[model samples]
Target chain A: METFILIGITGIGLGALYFLIASGLSLIYGLMGVLNFAHGSFLTVGAFVGFWVASKMGFETSMPEFILAMLVGGLAAGLFALLIEQLLITRLYDRHIDQALVTVGVSLVVGAVLGGWFGNDLRMFPAPLWFLSAIDIGGAKIPADRVVYIATAVLLLVGNWALLKFTRIGLIIRAGVENRNMVNALGINVRRAFSTVFFLGGFAAGVGGVLVSVYSNGVSPLIAATYLIYGFIVVVIGGMGSVPGSFLAAMMIGVIRQFANYYATGLGDFVVVILLAVVLLIRPQGLLGKVRS
Target chain B: MLRWKYSRPLLGLLIALLALAPILGANPLSRPGLQQTMAVAFIWGGLALTYDLLFGFTGLLSFGHALYFATGVYVSCILINHEVVVWWLAALISIAVSALLALLVGAASLRTTGITFAMVTLAFGEAGHVIIQRNFFNLTGGENGIALNADRIPSLFISVANTKFIYWAALAALIFTYAVIWWVTESSAGRVFAALRDNELRVQVLGLNTQRYKLLAFVISAALAALLGAVMLIAAGSAAPRFADAGVTISLLLMVVLGGAVTRWGAVIGGIFYSIATTRMQDLTQQESFKTIPKWIGGPIAEPALVLGLLFIFVVMFAPGGLSGAYYRLRLRAITKKSQ
Candidate 1:
């Protein structure tokens, strides 16, 4: 029972990380109709930049320097996404295939540049000392880091909801997701929404970068690349562009994977893939996605 | 239509010269490294052509085509290397299994359209790679990759001295691939494929099941990729995990796009160009003169991904038609001007 409890909690922690990545992917795909291959690079940029900031700022346990690092990382990633949107994505306009291909190119270039500019080795990312401790829950000892992950995800989720419901940009975004052509006909600047979506998506992915780095032993150039596959799966399963759906799917997949991994080592990934195929077979449009055509 | 009579003889002659290039160009290609590079290029050209059948002709953008190619290698290598079966039987079985895999995976992936299809195929391919790298069932040798067992390999296709035969085999395979693709593309089904790419709604209005035609293209393309993959194993004498990597699929995409998607010649040329660039560019960077270049320039130059990716972007942006498109564009203009 204790083991099960611990494993289940760890699964949620994993899901929390997956949701952070998937939410960005889901929102971006929903609005722009782009399968942004470079989304992973945003996460990587955030992680590397965040680490650099931490190193320079000097880690102080009492001062909460990691939070600042995470914020700065997300902001940097957001700006980078904006640049890509303006320079590459906007030029392609409504050419969805071209946009997707351009993202693939961007992803390759960014990954290569990061690898070439700053070696491909995995390096340590220093976390707050408080994150090193554990808390007991239901006789199962849970890592303190899991709590932070869940909190951050929930906070972001509510924040995303509030932004969408309460703000003018959010209202335009909501309308654009339903029918961008119609929204454009309504004289709203749907293009600005594209940039906003990219920025926001990149921000979430950037945060995911820091969270994922903290979850593991360290960060490597391929860190987000490894996670990007799962993010895609999550986005597809959750119904592309549905935040609430993503949260549910991420948690379900996470728990299922944890249980599967417990039964047999490394079986979870295979099981998850099968699950995706099965989902695709049954629900081609995804769990919450509207029929595109 | 006007010069179809002249084009056939010219094309046949080009192929004949290609098959006999190893002997005719013996001076330069005799270098084992050059021969091996050319052999890989031929296989890539074949793979890219098949990929074009799906992506360009059928309008399916698959990022997971490497799965079928990897299936051919792993199945054959595992059987041969582990002495599970004779080489010929293993090779036949590998090809068969790859077709079956394409059917199953294609059926599942074809359920989704556009971006979803691309992602689903990618996931399935990534899963295959992971299974191989993880050494599932303790058969794949994990990260070490599987080499063709020396004892089981045929006498005609083993050792550095036999690089010539391997080179010829790869050429034969490429020619066979080209012929099959050409024949299929000329058939009625090929017309349907073109229709499906241009407008599925119109095809659906004609009461045709677009999915069935798409599946046919997927299976045929995958089968062709598998055959070339077996040839690839023979050429390289091993199956590395990277054969199944997502990077390989991306490279195939690069080949098709660079050569021009709809044009068969573009696929082959793009494959050959990409292969030569990949192998030779790294070597080019390794040269003494290149070593003295500034770090800023040298670093990006050394990374093939950046260069190839930039080139792909350039093609997509400026030359949407690729090399064949550019050629056709110029030729069409000249004809128009002359007629006027």
Candidate 2:
């Protein structure tokens, strides 16, 4: 029971990380009808910056200060996302494929530059000491950091939900996702929603990057890409543009991968990929996605 | 002067030169090293042309082409080393398997279009990459990669000194690929592919099943791409995980775009040019002249991806038509000038 509890909670933690990346992908694809290929770059930037800030500012011991670094990292990524949106993506207008291509170019440039500057080895990310400690729950010593993951995901979900429910920007975004043509017909500047969604996605990517670095205990140029694939899987399985669906899919994938890996050693990834194929074959629109006409 | 009437003779002359390249001249062109490079370029030329059949001629923009290419390489390698199959039989089987896979993956992936199509293909390719790395049954050799069995390899290609034969083989593959593509592009089915690219809905409105046409293009291109892999496996004498990386597919995309999409010969040019330029760029970084340049400016330039990536962005942004596009534009201006 204790082992199951430990695996379950950690699985949820992994799912939380995936959600952080998937939510942004879902929202952007949902509203803008654009698939941001450079989305993983956003996370990479945030993680490196967050690590730099925490180390330089000597915040390794303080929980609040480290959290501050994570936010700063997210802010940097958000700003970068805005720049990409305005500079490259918006210029292409409605050429969706071209826009995606530009993001690929940007990702390549960024990836190479980072590799040139920092080299391609893993670097340890400093986390608060308490993060590594475990708390006894149901006779299982679960790592305390997982609680933070679940909490952050829940908080972001609720916060995003409230924003979509209450705010005018969120209203436009929600409307845009449902029917862009309808929103445009109603004289809504649906374009504004694209920017908001990119920024939100960027910020969330940053936070996830920092948090995942802590989870893995290291940061590398290649780190986000592996997770990004899983994020893409989560989005596809969850259905593009559906936040709640992403959360459910992420948790399911995370938990399944945990137990599968435990049982078969190196079989987790392959199983997940098989699952993705099955889902794609059976439910092309994803678990909660609307039938796109 | 630039008439299409002279194209056939010009192509014949070009083929003759390529065939005689290893021995025709002593001006640093016939060296074994240079021949090896040219051989690889020819294979890439063939590979890129096949990719064009799918992305350029047809409307599908698949990002997982590396899966087919890698499938050709690893399957052949494993069959010979592990299953003890003959090299010729292994090559044929790899081609067959790749085509069959293209059928299945295309059947599923074709359900989506545009962005979703790209993502679905990418997911499938990534799955292949991971599976190769997993080294199931010790056949794939895992991350360390697998070597071609020496005794199983054909006697003609056994010695490293026989690189010239490999060069001829690669050139033959490229010519064969080009001929097939040209024939297909001029066929009635090829006409449907152009229509599909321009407007799929319109094709559907014409009462044609566009999905079937797309699958046809996909399978043909995949089989041809596998041929390139077979040639490459013989050229390199081994199979590595690098062949399956997403980067390889992106490189194919770069080739097609740089050479000019939809144009019959553009992909060939793009592939050869990209392969040669990439190898040259890495060499440039090691030159003494590079040391004279400032470290800051030269540092990023040394990373070929940074330079090539920026170039790709420029091409996508400013030169939507690529090299062939540029040639056509110039020819258009010249014709107007002559008339005036």
Candidate 3:
């Protein structure tokens, strides 16, 4: 029971991170119809930036410092994404395959640049001392950091949902995702809306990256590839362009991965891939995605 | 109409060039490293040709094509290393197994369209790489990779140690692969592939089975890729799990697009050019003079992948048709000017 509870907690924490990353990818794909392969690079950028800020700030234990670091990290990533969107992505808007290839190229270049700058070694983000402590929750001792991460993820998810549901900009994005051409014809400036959504998605990925680095204790150049694959799997299983579906799929993958990691070691990834293939075969539209006409 | 007249002479010229490559490469006036580079180039060219069949002609963008290639290399090498079969028979068996694997992957992945198809294949490729690296450690030698004993290789084939033999063999393979692709593309089925690429819905409405044609293309492309993989194993004397890496698939896609998709000959040219460019770029980075530059400025230059990425973006934005497309446009201009 103890082991199961621990596993469940860890899985949920990891799922929260995946949810953040995959939601960004799904949102962008929904609105812009581009897979944004470079989304993983945003995560890497966020983690590294957060690490740099936290380290430079001298290992402060205050919650405010950590929040500031995360904000800076996310904003940096968002700015980078905005530049990329303006410079390269805007040219290949409707060309799906070209967009995929171009984004992949961007990812490779960004990864290489980061590796060059950071010397290809894993860099750690110093977590606040209080968050590092363990807390007793109903007879089970859980790491305080896990609880913080899960709480942050839940907050972000709820905030995003509210923003989409209540705001005019969010409504425009929702409409654009369903039918971009129609949204454009309706004179709502869909291009600007898509660009904003892209920025927001990158910001989410950045936040996820900061959280992951804090939890994992370090970040490496390879994180882009690893998380990109996970993000892709989540988006696929959750159905492309579906935020809630991404959230559900991310949690399921997280728990399954934890279980597989404990029982099978190296087979965890293979099992996830097999599950993806099976899901694709049985439910081509994804679990929560609407059927495309 | 113009293509019909020019294609025959173009093919003849290509065959003649390939036949003359070994001789040209071995000449004293040629650069010292040219022979080995050309041999590898031909091998990659063959792989890219097969890739074009799927991505360019058939309109399927598979990101896991390296799975088939690596399967061919590992299976053939394992069989030969274990003395279960001769090299020729091992190659044939590898092709069969690779085709079977392709069929399964195609069946599962082909159900989705566009980006979904690409992601599924990418997942499968990553899984295959991990399995080869971990699950089959004994058979695959894990991360260290499996090396075949030189003496165990059959005497009928030239030893892998001989660069000349490998070069000639790779050239022959490239030629043979090109001929096969050319034949297929020229035939009725090839027309059907082009049609499918243009509009799968229209073909389905015309009472043709689009799925069958796609499967056929997938199987053929996989088999050809596996054949090249076997040839590579024979040349290199070892196979690594990295052969199945997603990077390989991306590189193959880059080569196809760089050469010009849908143009059979373009893939060959692109593959050769990419191979040469990458090799030269790596060599340039490792030079003593290159290290003299500051880390921040020259750091990315040492990473070939960065350069490749920048090149891909440039190509996508400025020259979507690739080198072949550029050549065709120039030639069209020349013809028009001459007529005027």
Candidate 4:
């Protein structure tokens, strides 16, 4: 029972991280209709930036200070995304393969530059002392850091849901996702909406990156590709542009991965791959995705 | 000059030069290193041609084609090293296996078009890489990989250690692949593939089974890619998991794009150009004289990934149609000017 609880907690914590990353990917795909292959690179950049900031602030910093650093990092990533969207990505709109290739190129550039600068070594963000401690609950010990991560993820998820449900910009984004032409016909600036969504996606990815770095205790250039694959898996399983579906899929994958890791070393990735293939074969549109007419 | 009458002769001349490149290397003026590089380039050229057959001709942007290539390399290496088969037999078996694998992967992945197909394939490619690295059944030597014993290798492949012999073999392979692709592209089925690329729904509406044709193209491409992988294994006497990496697929994609998609001969040129350029870039960065350059400016050059990424972006932005497309346009302009 204790082992199960521990696994559940870990899975949920990891799931939260995956959700943060995949939500951004899902949103960008939904609103902009552009699959940003460079999404993971944003996470990598954000993590590194956040790490640098936190390291500079010293270990004595509180949780709020760390959160502030992560926010600043996310903003930086958002700025970068805006520039990329304006200069390059906007031109390749609706050219699916070209968009993929261009974004892949962008990812490669980002990853390579980071790798060159960081010397391919893993860098860690210092966790607060409280986060390093564990609390006993009903004979099961759970790490406080994981609880914090889960809380953050839940808060972000709610915040995003509310933003999409209630805000004007979110309404425009939702409309764009359904039918960009229809939204444009309504006289909304679809291009600006797309740019805004792209920036938000970048911010989400940036925040996810910071959280992941803190959770995993290290960051590396390879994280971009690895997490990109994970994010894609989650998005594909959940159905592209589906937020709730992404969250559900992310959690399932997180748990599945945890179990696989415990039972068979190095089999976790293969299991995920198999699951994706099976899912793709069974439901071409994904678990929660609607058929795009 | 852009007409088939002119281009056909030019292509023939290029093939003839490639065939005689090893003989040309017999002269001291031509370096052995050049021969080796060309050999590797020819193998890459064959791979690129296969990629173009799917991406350019069939309009399928598969990101997992390296799975088939790695399958060929690892399977052939394992069979030959274990004395289960000679190099020729291993190559044949590898080709078959790769075709079968392609059929399976295609049947599943082809259900989705565009980005979904790419993502599915990417997932499979990563899976293959992980499986190989895991050394399932101890057949794959884990990450250490399997090296073929020189004694176990067939006599024909034994001579592959000779740079000239490998050069000639790779040239022959490239020419053979090019001929096969050329024949296919000129066939009725090839026309169907072109139609599919232009618009799949239109082809489907025309009563043609687009799925079957797509599968056929995919299987052929996979088989050829595997053949090239086998050739590389024969040349190197070993196979590594790195061959299955997504980076390899990206490199092949780069070659296809840089040469010009939908153009067979362009892929061949692209492959050779990409291989040579990458090698030259690394060499340049490693030279002692490069140390004198400032760190910031020189830093990116030392990292080939950065350079390749930048090159990809530059090509996509400024030269979407690639070198072949540019040349064709230039020729068209000249002819129009003359007529004017």
Candidate 4 C-alpha lDDT tens digits along A175-213? 888888999998889888878877887887888888888
Q: How far off is residue A195 in model 4, in Å?
A: 1.3
List pairs with backbone clashes in candidate 4: none
What TM-score would you give candidate 4 relative to the actual structure? 0.95
lDDT of 2: 0.87
- TM-score of every candidate relative to the true structure: 0.97, 0.96, 0.94, 0.95
Ranking by DockQ: 3, 1, 2, 4
Docking class of 2: medium
Error of 1 at A76 (Å): 0.7
Superposition error at A229 for model 4 (Å): 0.9
After TM-score superposition, the amount by which residue B125's alpha carbon in candidate 4 deviates from its true location, in angstroms, is 1.0
**C-alpha RMSD over true interface residues, model 2:** 1.3
Residue pairs of candidate 3 with colliding backbone atoms: none
Local accuracy by lDDT, each model: 0.87, 0.87, 0.84, 0.84
Using Cα atoms, each model's DockQ against the true complex is 0.69, 0.64, 0.73, 0.63
Model 4 chain B worst lDDT window (10 residues)? B21-30
Q: Estimate, for each residue in B1-340, the C-alpha lDDT of model 4 and write its tens digit.
A: 5855667789789777766655664663145677778888999999999999999999988889999999899989888888998778998999999999999988988888878788888888888988999888899898989997778765655653467777777888898899899999899999999999999999999999988999999999999988988888877778988899988898999999989988787888899988888888888988999988887667755777788788888888778888888888888998899899
lDDT of 3 by residue, B1-340 (tens): 2264677889789777756654575553144256567878989999999999999998888889999999999999898889888778998999999999999988998888778888888888888898898845478888888997666776534543456667777888898899899899888999898999889899999999888898889899999999999988877679988798988998999998888888787899999989898898888988999889999978877787788889888888889988887878887887788889
Which regions of candidate 3 are displaced past 4 Å?
Answer: A59-62, A129-144, B1-33, B155-161
Clashing pairs in model 2? none
